[model samples]
Target: MEVKRMTDREIVFRLLRYEQANLRNYQNYLAYTKNKDLSAYIARTIPQIEGNIKSLNVLSRKLCGG
Candidate 1:
């Protein structure tokens, strides 16, 4: 088994992708969950995930010079 190290840019891109997927999953869960408490928790968590995605996008742009 071999372990590969990722560059900073690659790591940022991976983080951005992961956050995007997580945001989508959270939204799906929020829509389908019937429990009010869980829904509220998901709602609260969504903003933080969105913020992370936004920040990662900014970082990506900075790295790529777009």
Candidate 2:
């Protein structure tokens, strides 16, 4: 089996997709969790994920020319 390398754009796309997926999961968990502590934890974690997504989105836009 041979490994394939990804270009910078491909890597950025994958990272953005993964971060979006995590954001969705955290949103769902925060919305549906019955335990208050768990919900709070999810809420706390979500902002970091959101910040990463925002940064990646900016990078993607920069790569794509605004």
Candidate 3:
């Protein structure tokens, strides 16, 4: 069997997609949650996820020679 190698740009793109999906899921969960503490936690986490995506995008651009 042959192994396939991944590039830094490809990896960052996949990570960006994953982080975006998680952010969406967290937003939906926050909307449905009734517990104040949990909702607060989820809301706060959403920004962190966004920050991760932002950082990944910057990395991806650099990897792509943009």
**Which of the numbered candidates is closest to the native, going by highest lDDT?**
1
Sorted on TM-score, highest at the top, how do the candidates line up? 3, 1, 2
- Across 12-66, the per-residue lDDT of candidate 3 in tens digits comes to 9999999999998999999899999999999889999999999998998899889
TM-score for predicted model 3 compared with the true structure: 0.93
Which residue pairs collide in model 3, if any?
none
Instruction: List CA RMSD, all candidates.
Output: 1.5, 1.5, 0.8
Question: Alpha-carbon error at 49 in model 1, in Å?
Answer: 0.5
The regions of model 1 sitting more than 4 angstroms off are 1-3
Candidate scoring better on TM-score of 1 and 3: 3
Give the C-alpha miss distance for residue 53 in model 2, angstroms.
0.7
Supply the global lDDT for candidate 3. 0.93
Model 1 local distance difference test score: 0.95
lDDT of each: 0.95, 0.92, 0.93
Tens-digit lDDT track for model 1 on 1-66? 999989889999999989999999999999999999999999999999999999998999898989
Q: Candidate 1, after superposition: displacement of residue 11 in Å? A: 0.2
- Model 3, C-alpha of 56: deviation from truth (Å): 0.6
Give TM-scores for every candidate, taking all chains together and pairing residue i with residue i: 0.89, 0.84, 0.93
Model 1: ten consecutive residues of lowest lDDT: 56-65
